[model samples]
Target: MSRIAKRFAETRASGRAALIPYVTAGDPAPDVTVPLLHDLVAAGADLLELGVPFSDPMADGPVIQLACERSLAHGTRLRDVLAMVREFRQTDSETPVVLMGYLNPVERMGAEVFASAAAEAGVDGVLMVDLPPEESDDLTGLLERAGIDPIFLVAPTTADARLSHVAAAARGFIYYVSLKGVTGAQSLDPAALGARLGAIRAITELPLGVGFGIRDAATAGAVARVADAVVVGSAIVRLAEQYPDAPERFRAAAAELAREMRTAMDAARADAAPAAV
Candidate 1:
Protein backbone atom coordinates (compact mmCIF):
# COMPACT_ATOMS: atom_id res chain seq x y z
CA MET A 1 0.00 0.00 0.00
CA SER A 2 1.01 3.62 -0.41
CA ARG A 3 2.41 5.30 2.66
CA ILE A 4 -0.72 7.45 3.06
CA ALA A 5 -3.14 4.54 2.66
CA LYS A 6 -1.05 2.44 5.04
CA ARG A 7 -0.96 5.13 7.70
CA PHE A 8 -4.70 5.82 7.46
CA ALA A 9 -5.43 2.09 7.66
CA GLU A 10 -3.23 1.78 10.72
CA THR A 11 -4.92 4.71 12.42
CA ARG A 12 -8.37 3.37 11.60
CA ALA A 13 -7.45 -0.01 13.04
CA SER A 14 -6.35 1.72 16.22
CA GLY A 15 -9.83 3.28 16.46
CA ARG A 16 -8.41 6.79 16.43
CA ALA A 17 -8.57 9.50 13.85
CA ALA A 18 -5.29 10.45 12.21
CA LEU A 19 -3.64 13.70 13.19
CA ILE A 20 -2.18 15.57 10.23
CA PRO A 21 -0.17 18.70 11.03
CA TYR A 22 0.82 21.30 8.44
CA VAL A 23 3.71 23.75 8.33
CA THR A 24 5.27 25.86 5.65
CA ALA A 25 8.62 24.64 4.40
CA GLY A 26 11.53 27.00 5.23
CA ASP A 27 9.48 29.00 7.67
CA PRO A 28 11.61 30.79 10.25
CA ALA A 29 14.67 29.28 8.52
CA PRO A 30 15.19 26.89 5.67
CA ASP A 31 17.51 24.67 7.68
CA VAL A 32 15.05 24.07 10.53
CA THR A 33 12.26 22.48 8.47
CA VAL A 34 13.53 18.87 8.49
CA PRO A 35 14.01 18.89 12.26
CA LEU A 36 10.56 20.40 12.72
CA LEU A 37 9.14 17.70 10.46
CA HIS A 38 10.73 15.07 12.66
CA ASP A 39 9.44 16.77 15.78
CA LEU A 40 5.87 16.72 14.43
CA VAL A 41 6.06 12.97 13.81
CA ALA A 42 7.54 12.43 17.26
CA ALA A 43 4.58 14.29 18.69
CA GLY A 44 2.13 11.83 17.06
CA ALA A 45 1.40 13.40 13.71
CA ASP A 46 0.35 10.52 11.44
CA LEU A 47 0.88 12.52 8.26
CA LEU A 48 2.74 15.73 7.39
CA GLU A 49 1.64 18.48 5.01
CA LEU A 50 4.55 20.74 4.09
CA GLY A 51 3.50 23.94 2.38
CA VAL A 52 5.58 24.92 -0.64
CA PRO A 53 5.91 28.71 -0.34
CA PHE A 54 4.39 30.56 -3.24
CA SER A 55 4.10 34.21 -4.30
CA ASP A 56 0.31 34.08 -4.22
CA PRO A 57 -1.46 31.85 -1.70
CA MET A 58 -4.98 33.16 -2.20
CA ALA A 59 -6.60 30.28 -0.40
CA ASP A 60 -4.47 30.86 2.71
CA GLY A 61 -5.22 33.43 5.37
CA PRO A 62 -2.85 36.08 6.65
CA VAL A 63 -0.87 33.73 8.90
CA ILE A 64 -0.01 31.21 6.19
CA GLN A 65 0.47 34.04 3.71
CA LEU A 66 3.08 35.56 5.99
CA ALA A 67 4.67 32.17 6.41
CA CYS A 68 5.07 31.91 2.67
CA GLU A 69 6.58 35.36 2.56
CA ARG A 70 9.11 34.45 5.23
CA SER A 71 10.06 31.29 3.37
CA LEU A 72 10.33 33.05 0.04
CA ALA A 73 12.43 35.80 1.55
CA HIS A 74 14.95 33.19 2.63
CA GLY A 75 15.35 32.12 -1.01
CA THR A 76 13.48 28.87 -0.40
CA ARG A 77 12.43 27.37 -3.70
CA LEU A 78 10.39 24.34 -4.75
CA ARG A 79 13.60 22.32 -4.96
CA ASP A 80 14.58 23.36 -1.44
CA VAL A 81 11.26 22.11 -0.05
CA LEU A 82 11.71 18.78 -1.86
CA ALA A 83 15.26 18.56 -0.47
CA MET A 84 13.88 19.05 3.02
CA VAL A 85 11.54 16.10 2.47
CA ARG A 86 14.48 14.04 1.18
CA GLU A 87 16.54 14.89 4.24
CA PHE A 88 13.60 14.04 6.50
CA ARG A 89 13.41 10.58 4.93
CA GLN A 90 16.96 9.76 6.06
CA THR A 91 15.86 8.78 9.57
CA ASP A 92 12.08 8.36 9.34
CA SER A 93 10.47 6.61 6.40
CA GLU A 94 7.07 5.59 7.70
CA THR A 95 5.01 8.76 8.06
CA PRO A 96 3.56 10.16 4.84
CA VAL A 97 4.60 13.65 3.74
CA VAL A 98 2.26 15.60 1.43
CA LEU A 99 3.43 18.72 -0.37
CA MET A 100 0.74 21.46 -0.25
CA GLY A 101 1.16 24.41 -2.56
CA TYR A 102 -0.03 26.26 -5.67
CA LEU A 103 0.25 25.15 -9.29
CA ASN A 104 2.58 27.96 -10.39
CA PRO A 105 5.65 26.28 -9.02
CA VAL A 106 4.76 22.89 -10.45
CA GLU A 107 3.97 24.40 -13.82
CA ARG A 108 7.29 26.23 -13.73
CA MET A 109 9.08 22.93 -13.10
CA GLY A 110 6.88 20.99 -15.55
CA ALA A 111 4.40 18.43 -14.21
CA GLU A 112 6.45 15.33 -15.06
CA VAL A 113 9.69 16.79 -13.72
CA PHE A 114 8.01 17.94 -10.54
CA ALA A 115 6.30 14.58 -10.03
CA SER A 116 9.53 12.65 -10.43
CA ALA A 117 11.37 15.02 -8.12
CA ALA A 118 8.64 14.83 -5.43
CA ALA A 119 8.56 11.02 -5.57
CA GLU A 120 12.34 10.93 -5.27
CA ALA A 121 12.11 13.25 -2.28
CA GLY A 122 9.89 10.76 -0.48
CA VAL A 123 6.74 12.86 -0.85
CA ASP A 124 3.63 10.68 -0.81
CA GLY A 125 1.10 13.26 -2.03
CA VAL A 126 0.53 16.77 -3.37
CA LEU A 127 -2.37 19.19 -2.63
CA MET A 128 -2.45 22.24 -4.84
CA VAL A 129 -5.04 24.74 -3.60
CA ASP A 130 -5.63 26.45 -6.93
CA LEU A 131 -5.71 23.37 -9.15
CA PRO A 132 -9.20 22.01 -9.71
CA PRO A 133 -9.83 18.41 -10.76
CA GLU A 134 -11.08 19.37 -14.19
CA GLU A 135 -7.76 21.00 -15.05
CA SER A 136 -5.51 18.67 -13.07
CA ASP A 137 -5.03 15.81 -15.53
CA ASP A 138 -1.54 16.95 -16.53
CA LEU A 139 -0.36 16.97 -12.92
CA THR A 140 -2.50 14.15 -11.57
CA GLY A 141 -1.57 11.81 -14.40
CA LEU A 142 2.11 12.42 -13.79
CA LEU A 143 1.72 12.11 -10.02
CA GLU A 144 -0.10 8.77 -10.27
CA ARG A 145 2.61 7.51 -12.63
CA ALA A 146 5.23 8.49 -10.06
CA GLY A 147 3.31 6.71 -7.30
CA ILE A 148 2.49 10.01 -5.64
CA ASP A 149 -1.09 10.86 -4.71
CA PRO A 150 -2.97 13.87 -5.99
CA ILE A 151 -4.97 15.02 -2.99
CA PHE A 152 -7.89 17.39 -3.60
CA LEU A 153 -9.96 19.68 -1.38
CA VAL A 154 -13.76 19.70 -1.05
CA ALA A 155 -15.27 22.80 0.41
CA PRO A 156 -18.61 23.17 2.21
CA THR A 157 -20.08 24.87 -0.81
CA THR A 158 -19.16 21.99 -3.11
CA ALA A 159 -22.04 20.44 -5.04
CA ASP A 160 -22.74 16.71 -5.01
CA ALA A 161 -21.81 16.40 -8.66
CA ARG A 162 -18.47 18.11 -8.09
CA LEU A 163 -17.92 15.97 -5.02
CA SER A 164 -18.25 12.86 -7.19
CA HIS A 165 -15.88 14.35 -9.74
CA VAL A 166 -13.33 15.21 -7.05
CA ALA A 167 -13.69 11.84 -5.39
CA ALA A 168 -13.08 10.14 -8.73
CA ALA A 169 -9.93 12.18 -9.42
CA ALA A 170 -8.52 12.24 -5.90
CA ARG A 171 -6.01 9.84 -4.44
CA GLY A 172 -4.55 9.42 -0.92
CA PHE A 173 -7.60 11.16 0.65
CA ILE A 174 -10.01 14.03 0.15
CA TYR A 175 -9.50 17.13 2.29
CA TYR A 176 -12.87 18.56 3.36
CA VAL A 177 -12.53 22.23 4.15
CA SER A 178 -14.58 22.61 7.32
CA LEU A 179 -15.59 26.15 6.53
CA LYS A 180 -16.32 28.26 3.49
CA GLY A 181 -13.70 30.89 4.18
CA VAL A 182 -9.93 30.73 3.82
CA THR A 183 -7.68 28.78 6.16
CA GLY A 184 -7.60 30.05 9.80
CA ALA A 185 -11.15 31.30 9.74
CA GLN A 186 -12.75 30.08 12.96
CA SER A 187 -16.26 29.02 12.04
CA LEU A 188 -16.37 25.25 12.44
CA ASP A 189 -19.65 23.86 13.75
CA PRO A 190 -19.11 20.22 14.72
CA ALA A 191 -22.82 19.26 14.61
CA ALA A 192 -23.23 20.74 11.16
CA LEU A 193 -19.90 19.32 10.06
CA GLY A 194 -20.98 15.83 11.12
CA ALA A 195 -24.10 16.11 9.00
CA ARG A 196 -22.08 17.28 6.02
CA LEU A 197 -19.64 14.43 6.46
CA GLY A 198 -22.55 12.00 6.54
CA ALA A 199 -23.68 13.30 3.17
CA ILE A 200 -20.13 13.09 1.79
CA ARG A 201 -19.80 9.55 3.06
CA ALA A 202 -22.76 8.50 0.95
CA ILE A 203 -20.79 9.45 -2.17
CA THR A 204 -17.34 7.95 -1.73
CA GLU A 205 -15.59 5.56 0.59
CA LEU A 206 -12.23 7.29 0.27
CA PRO A 207 -10.79 8.46 3.57
CA LEU A 208 -12.21 11.90 4.38
CA GLY A 209 -9.94 14.41 6.10
CA VAL A 210 -11.43 17.61 7.54
CA GLY A 211 -9.31 20.76 7.87
CA PHE A 212 -9.28 24.66 7.83
CA GLY A 213 -10.84 25.42 11.25
CA ILE A 214 -9.49 22.80 13.59
CA ARG A 215 -7.37 24.84 16.04
CA ASP A 216 -7.00 22.80 19.22
CA ALA A 217 -7.68 19.61 21.12
CA ALA A 218 -11.38 20.23 21.70
CA THR A 219 -12.04 21.07 18.07
CA ALA A 220 -9.84 18.26 16.85
CA GLY A 221 -11.59 15.74 19.08
CA ALA A 222 -14.98 16.92 17.96
CA VAL A 223 -14.11 16.53 14.34
CA ALA A 224 -12.33 13.25 15.00
CA ARG A 225 -15.65 11.68 15.92
CA VAL A 226 -16.83 12.03 12.34
CA ALA A 227 -13.81 12.37 10.07
CA ASP A 228 -11.04 9.94 9.19
CA ALA A 229 -8.40 12.62 9.78
CA VAL A 230 -8.20 16.02 11.47
CA VAL A 231 -5.78 18.48 9.91
CA VAL A 232 -4.43 21.36 12.01
CA GLY A 233 -2.58 24.05 10.06
CA SER A 234 -2.90 27.73 11.01
CA ALA A 235 -2.66 26.93 14.71
CA ILE A 236 0.74 25.28 14.18
CA VAL A 237 1.89 27.94 11.74
CA ARG A 238 0.97 30.51 14.34
CA LEU A 239 3.46 28.82 16.66
CA ALA A 240 6.23 29.32 14.12
CA GLU A 241 5.33 32.98 13.89
CA GLN A 242 5.14 33.30 17.67
CA TYR A 243 8.70 32.06 18.05
CA PRO A 244 10.28 32.93 14.74
CA ASP A 245 13.70 33.69 16.18
CA ALA A 246 13.75 30.52 18.31
CA PRO A 247 13.37 27.40 16.20
CA GLU A 248 13.65 25.06 19.17
CA ARG A 249 10.88 26.92 20.97
CA PHE A 250 8.72 26.75 17.87
CA ARG A 251 9.18 23.00 17.60
CA ALA A 252 8.43 22.55 21.29
CA ALA A 253 5.25 24.57 21.01
CA ALA A 254 4.13 22.78 17.89
CA ALA A 255 4.86 19.34 19.38
CA GLU A 256 2.99 20.13 22.58
CA LEU A 257 -0.12 21.19 20.68
CA ALA A 258 0.04 18.15 18.43
CA ARG A 259 0.42 15.82 21.39
CA GLU A 260 -2.54 17.41 23.14
CA MET A 261 -4.72 17.03 20.06
CA ARG A 262 -3.63 13.44 19.58
CA THR A 263 -4.46 12.60 23.17
CA ALA A 264 -7.86 14.21 22.92
CA MET A 265 -8.72 12.47 19.66
CA ASP A 266 -7.70 9.08 21.04
CA ALA A 267 -9.76 9.65 24.15
CA ALA A 268 -12.73 10.69 22.06
CA ARG A 269 -12.38 7.58 19.97
CA ALA A 270 -12.33 5.37 23.04
CA ASP A 271 -15.42 7.12 24.34
CA ALA A 272 -17.19 6.32 21.06
CA ALA A 273 -16.03 2.70 21.05
CA PRO A 274 -18.77 0.10 20.77
CA ALA A 275 -19.59 -2.00 23.85
CA ALA A 276 -17.96 -5.44 23.90
CA VAL A 277 -20.45 -8.24 23.53
Candidate 2:
Protein backbone atom coordinates (compact mmCIF):
# COMPACT_ATOMS: atom_id res chain seq x y z
CA MET A 1 0.00 0.00 0.00
CA SER A 2 1.08 3.60 -0.55
CA ARG A 3 2.51 5.33 2.50
CA ILE A 4 -0.52 7.64 2.60
CA ALA A 5 -2.98 4.73 2.37
CA LYS A 6 -1.06 2.81 4.99
CA ARG A 7 -0.94 5.77 7.35
CA PHE A 8 -4.68 6.35 6.99
CA ALA A 9 -5.39 2.64 7.50
CA GLU A 10 -3.17 2.60 10.58
CA THR A 11 -4.79 5.71 12.02
CA ARG A 12 -8.21 4.25 11.33
CA ALA A 13 -7.36 1.08 13.18
CA SER A 14 -6.19 3.17 16.11
CA GLY A 15 -9.54 4.97 16.11
CA ARG A 16 -7.90 8.39 15.80
CA ALA A 17 -7.87 10.91 13.03
CA ALA A 18 -4.56 11.49 11.29
CA LEU A 19 -2.93 14.87 11.99
CA ILE A 20 -1.57 16.45 8.83
CA PRO A 21 0.35 19.69 9.26
CA TYR A 22 1.17 22.01 6.37
CA VAL A 23 4.30 24.15 6.25
CA THR A 24 5.92 26.04 3.43
CA ALA A 25 9.23 24.72 2.14
CA GLY A 26 12.13 27.09 2.84
CA ASP A 27 10.01 29.31 5.08
CA PRO A 28 12.06 31.35 7.57
CA ALA A 29 15.10 29.86 5.81
CA PRO A 30 15.82 27.10 3.33
CA ASP A 31 17.94 25.12 5.77
CA VAL A 32 15.14 25.00 8.33
CA THR A 33 12.81 22.98 6.08
CA VAL A 34 14.26 19.50 6.58
CA PRO A 35 14.74 19.67 10.34
CA LEU A 36 11.37 21.34 10.84
CA LEU A 37 9.83 18.41 8.96
CA HIS A 38 11.41 15.95 11.40
CA ASP A 39 10.30 18.10 14.33
CA LEU A 40 6.72 18.00 13.13
CA VAL A 41 6.84 14.21 12.79
CA ALA A 42 8.20 13.99 16.31
CA ALA A 43 5.28 16.18 17.40
CA GLY A 44 2.76 13.53 16.30
CA ALA A 45 2.07 14.44 12.71
CA ASP A 46 0.90 11.38 10.76
CA LEU A 47 1.76 13.08 7.46
CA LEU A 48 3.23 16.34 6.20
CA GLU A 49 2.26 18.77 3.46
CA LEU A 50 5.19 20.87 2.26
CA GLY A 51 4.15 23.91 0.30
CA VAL A 52 6.14 24.60 -2.88
CA PRO A 53 6.70 28.37 -2.87
CA PHE A 54 5.11 30.03 -5.84
CA SER A 55 4.87 33.57 -7.21
CA ASP A 56 1.09 33.53 -7.17
CA PRO A 57 -0.80 31.42 -4.63
CA MET A 58 -4.30 32.60 -5.48
CA ALA A 59 -6.15 30.17 -3.27
CA ASP A 60 -4.10 31.04 -0.20
CA GLY A 61 -4.75 33.83 2.27
CA PRO A 62 -2.26 36.49 3.44
CA VAL A 63 -0.53 34.20 5.95
CA ILE A 64 0.47 31.51 3.48
CA GLN A 65 1.00 34.14 0.81
CA LEU A 66 3.62 35.75 3.06
CA ALA A 67 5.10 32.33 3.70
CA CYS A 68 5.46 31.83 -0.05
CA GLU A 69 7.10 35.23 -0.32
CA ARG A 70 9.52 34.46 2.49
CA SER A 71 10.44 31.15 0.90
CA LEU A 72 10.81 32.70 -2.52
CA ALA A 73 12.94 35.47 -1.05
CA HIS A 74 15.50 32.81 -0.23
CA GLY A 75 15.40 31.77 -3.90
CA THR A 76 13.69 28.53 -2.93
CA ARG A 77 12.62 26.64 -6.02
CA LEU A 78 10.65 23.48 -6.62
CA ARG A 79 13.93 21.61 -6.99
CA ASP A 80 15.07 22.90 -3.60
CA VAL A 81 11.83 21.67 -2.03
CA LEU A 82 12.46 18.26 -3.60
CA ALA A 83 16.01 18.28 -2.26
CA MET A 84 14.67 18.95 1.25
CA VAL A 85 12.37 15.96 0.88
CA ARG A 86 15.29 13.81 -0.27
CA GLU A 87 17.32 14.83 2.76
CA PHE A 88 14.34 14.16 5.03
CA ARG A 89 14.07 10.63 3.62
CA GLN A 90 17.63 9.77 4.68
CA THR A 91 16.57 9.05 8.27
CA ASP A 92 12.80 8.72 8.08
CA SER A 93 11.21 6.66 5.34
CA GLU A 94 7.83 5.87 6.82
CA THR A 95 6.14 9.27 7.07
CA PRO A 96 4.51 10.38 3.85
CA VAL A 97 5.28 13.84 2.44
CA VAL A 98 2.91 15.56 0.06
CA LEU A 99 4.00 18.56 -2.05
CA MET A 100 1.27 21.21 -2.06
CA GLY A 101 1.30 24.27 -4.32
CA TYR A 102 0.38 25.80 -7.64
CA LEU A 103 0.85 24.40 -11.15
CA ASN A 104 3.21 27.03 -12.52
CA PRO A 105 6.30 25.42 -11.04
CA VAL A 106 5.36 21.98 -12.29
CA GLU A 107 4.59 23.33 -15.74
CA ARG A 108 7.92 25.15 -15.74
CA MET A 109 9.78 21.96 -14.85
CA GLY A 110 7.65 19.90 -17.20
CA ALA A 111 5.10 17.57 -15.59
CA GLU A 112 7.03 14.42 -16.51
CA VAL A 113 10.27 15.83 -15.17
CA PHE A 114 8.65 17.06 -11.95
CA ALA A 115 6.95 13.71 -11.38
CA SER A 116 10.24 11.79 -11.72
CA ALA A 117 12.11 14.25 -9.52
CA ALA A 118 9.41 14.19 -6.83
CA ALA A 119 9.34 10.37 -6.79
CA GLU A 120 13.11 10.29 -6.52
CA ALA A 121 12.90 12.76 -3.65
CA GLY A 122 10.58 10.33 -1.80
CA VAL A 123 7.46 12.46 -2.13
CA ASP A 124 4.35 10.31 -1.80
CA GLY A 125 1.69 12.72 -3.03
CA VAL A 126 1.17 16.02 -4.91
CA LEU A 127 -1.61 18.58 -4.37
CA MET A 128 -1.64 21.27 -7.06
CA VAL A 129 -4.23 23.78 -5.89
CA ASP A 130 -5.28 25.17 -9.25
CA LEU A 131 -5.23 21.92 -11.21
CA PRO A 132 -8.85 20.94 -11.42
CA PRO A 133 -9.62 17.26 -11.85
CA GLU A 134 -11.26 17.87 -15.20
CA GLU A 135 -8.01 19.27 -16.63
CA SER A 136 -5.57 17.04 -14.74
CA ASP A 137 -5.47 13.87 -16.80
CA ASP A 138 -2.01 14.30 -18.36
CA LEU A 139 -0.25 15.43 -15.20
CA THR A 140 -2.14 12.93 -13.05
CA GLY A 141 -1.10 10.13 -15.41
CA LEU A 142 2.53 11.18 -15.08
CA LEU A 143 2.26 11.27 -11.27
CA GLU A 144 0.59 7.83 -11.08
CA ARG A 145 3.25 6.35 -13.34
CA ALA A 146 5.89 7.74 -10.97
CA GLY A 147 4.18 6.00 -8.01
CA ILE A 148 2.88 9.27 -6.61
CA ASP A 149 -0.70 9.91 -5.62
CA PRO A 150 -2.31 12.94 -7.29
CA ILE A 151 -4.34 14.51 -4.49
CA PHE A 152 -7.17 16.95 -5.17
CA LEU A 153 -9.24 19.47 -3.23
CA VAL A 154 -13.04 19.57 -3.00
CA ALA A 155 -14.73 22.80 -2.00
CA PRO A 156 -18.04 23.37 -0.23
CA THR A 157 -19.38 24.81 -3.46
CA THR A 158 -18.60 21.77 -5.58
CA ALA A 159 -21.64 20.28 -7.28
CA ASP A 160 -22.47 16.60 -7.05
CA ALA A 161 -21.70 16.11 -10.76
CA ARG A 162 -18.31 17.79 -10.37
CA LEU A 163 -17.65 15.70 -7.27
CA SER A 164 -17.89 12.58 -9.36
CA HIS A 165 -15.13 13.96 -11.55
CA VAL A 166 -12.95 14.56 -8.49
CA ALA A 167 -13.68 11.08 -7.17
CA ALA A 168 -12.67 9.63 -10.51
CA ALA A 169 -9.40 11.58 -10.61
CA ALA A 170 -8.24 11.77 -7.01
CA ARG A 171 -5.92 9.43 -5.14
CA GLY A 172 -4.34 9.58 -1.70
CA PHE A 173 -7.15 11.54 0.03
CA ILE A 174 -9.65 14.25 -0.79
CA TYR A 175 -8.93 17.62 0.89
CA TYR A 176 -12.24 19.21 1.79
CA VAL A 177 -11.79 22.96 2.17
CA SER A 178 -13.85 23.55 5.33
CA LEU A 179 -14.80 27.07 4.29
CA LYS A 180 -15.63 28.89 1.11
CA GLY A 181 -12.88 31.46 1.40
CA VAL A 182 -9.11 31.13 1.01
CA THR A 183 -6.87 29.28 3.45
CA GLY A 184 -6.82 30.93 6.91
CA ALA A 185 -10.26 32.42 6.58
CA GLN A 186 -12.35 31.97 9.71
CA SER A 187 -15.90 30.83 10.61
CA LEU A 188 -15.91 27.02 10.52
CA ASP A 189 -19.15 25.54 11.81
CA PRO A 190 -18.56 21.87 12.59
CA ALA A 191 -22.25 21.02 12.54
CA ALA A 192 -22.57 22.37 9.01
CA LEU A 193 -19.23 20.85 8.09
CA GLY A 194 -20.34 17.44 9.35
CA ALA A 195 -23.42 17.62 7.17
CA ARG A 196 -21.34 18.58 4.16
CA LEU A 197 -18.88 15.80 4.86
CA GLY A 198 -21.78 13.36 5.03
CA ALA A 199 -22.68 14.33 1.46
CA ILE A 200 -19.10 13.86 0.32
CA ARG A 201 -18.77 10.54 2.14
CA ALA A 202 -21.69 9.27 0.11
CA ILE A 203 -19.75 9.96 -3.08
CA THR A 204 -16.25 8.56 -2.48
CA GLU A 205 -14.42 6.05 -0.33
CA LEU A 206 -11.14 8.03 -0.26
CA PRO A 207 -10.21 9.37 3.16
CA LEU A 208 -11.58 12.87 3.65
CA GLY A 209 -9.42 15.60 5.23
CA VAL A 210 -10.85 18.98 6.30
CA GLY A 211 -8.75 22.15 6.36
CA PHE A 212 -8.76 26.02 5.95
CA GLY A 213 -9.99 27.15 9.37
CA ILE A 214 -8.51 24.68 11.81
CA ARG A 215 -6.48 27.08 13.97
CA ASP A 216 -6.47 25.46 17.40
CA ALA A 217 -6.97 22.24 19.34
CA ALA A 218 -10.68 22.92 19.73
CA THR A 219 -11.12 23.39 15.98
CA ALA A 220 -8.96 20.36 15.26
CA GLY A 221 -10.94 18.25 17.72
CA ALA A 222 -14.18 19.33 16.15
CA VAL A 223 -12.93 18.52 12.68
CA ALA A 224 -11.52 15.17 13.82
CA ARG A 225 -14.95 13.98 14.84
CA VAL A 226 -16.10 14.02 11.20
CA ALA A 227 -12.93 13.88 9.12
CA ASP A 228 -10.58 10.96 8.61
CA ALA A 229 -7.77 13.53 8.69
CA VAL A 230 -7.54 17.04 10.15
CA VAL A 231 -5.30 19.31 8.07
CA VAL A 232 -3.82 22.33 9.85
CA GLY A 233 -1.99 24.90 7.75
CA SER A 234 -2.05 28.67 8.25
CA ALA A 235 -2.16 28.39 12.02
CA ILE A 236 1.21 26.60 11.98
CA VAL A 237 2.73 28.67 9.19
CA ARG A 238 1.93 31.75 11.24
CA LEU A 239 4.74 30.66 13.53
CA ALA A 240 7.26 31.12 10.75
CA GLU A 241 5.88 34.58 10.16
CA GLN A 242 6.30 35.37 13.85
CA TYR A 243 9.85 34.05 14.09
CA PRO A 244 11.37 34.74 10.74
CA ASP A 245 14.98 34.46 11.86
CA ALA A 246 14.62 31.90 14.62
CA PRO A 247 14.28 28.42 13.16
CA GLU A 248 14.55 26.76 16.54
CA ARG A 249 11.70 28.79 17.97
CA PHE A 250 9.58 28.20 14.92
CA ARG A 251 10.18 24.46 15.19
CA ALA A 252 9.33 24.42 18.87
CA ALA A 253 6.13 26.44 18.59
CA ALA A 254 4.92 24.60 15.51
CA ALA A 255 5.53 21.23 17.09
CA GLU A 256 3.74 22.27 20.25
CA LEU A 257 0.68 23.32 18.28
CA ALA A 258 0.75 20.01 16.41
CA ARG A 259 0.99 18.07 19.65
CA GLU A 260 -1.98 19.95 21.06
CA MET A 261 -4.02 19.19 17.96
CA ARG A 262 -3.03 15.54 18.08
CA THR A 263 -3.99 15.17 21.71
CA ALA A 264 -7.30 16.93 21.23
CA MET A 265 -8.15 14.91 18.15
CA ASP A 266 -7.50 11.63 19.94
CA ALA A 267 -9.54 12.69 22.93
CA ALA A 268 -12.39 13.82 20.72
CA ARG A 269 -12.51 10.46 18.97
CA ALA A 270 -12.48 8.56 22.23
CA ASP A 271 -15.31 10.69 23.56
CA ALA A 272 -17.34 9.98 20.45
CA ALA A 273 -16.67 6.25 20.60
CA PRO A 274 -19.38 3.90 21.89
CA ALA A 275 -19.14 2.94 25.56
CA ALA A 276 -18.33 -0.64 26.45
CA VAL A 277 -21.58 -2.61 26.76
Question: Compared to the true structure, candidate 1 yields what TM-score?
Answer: 0.98
Clash numbers, per candidate: 0, 0
Model 2: per-residue Cα lDDT over 1-277, one tens digit each? 9999999999988898999999999998999999999999999999999999998899999999999999999999999999999999999999999999999999999999999999999999999999998789999999999999999999999999999889889999999999999999997999999999999989999999999999999999989999999999999999999998788999999999999999999999999887511
Q: Score candidate 2 by lDDT.
A: 0.95
Worst 10 residues of 2 by lDDT: 268-277
Query: Which lDDT value does model 1 have at 60?
Result: 96
Task: For model 2, state the Cα shift of residue 172 in Å.
Answer: 0.8
The residue-level lDDT of candidate 1 at 257 comes to: 98
TM-score of each: 0.98, 0.98
Candidate 2 positional error at 95, Å: 0.5
> What's the lDDT for residue 83 in model 1?
95
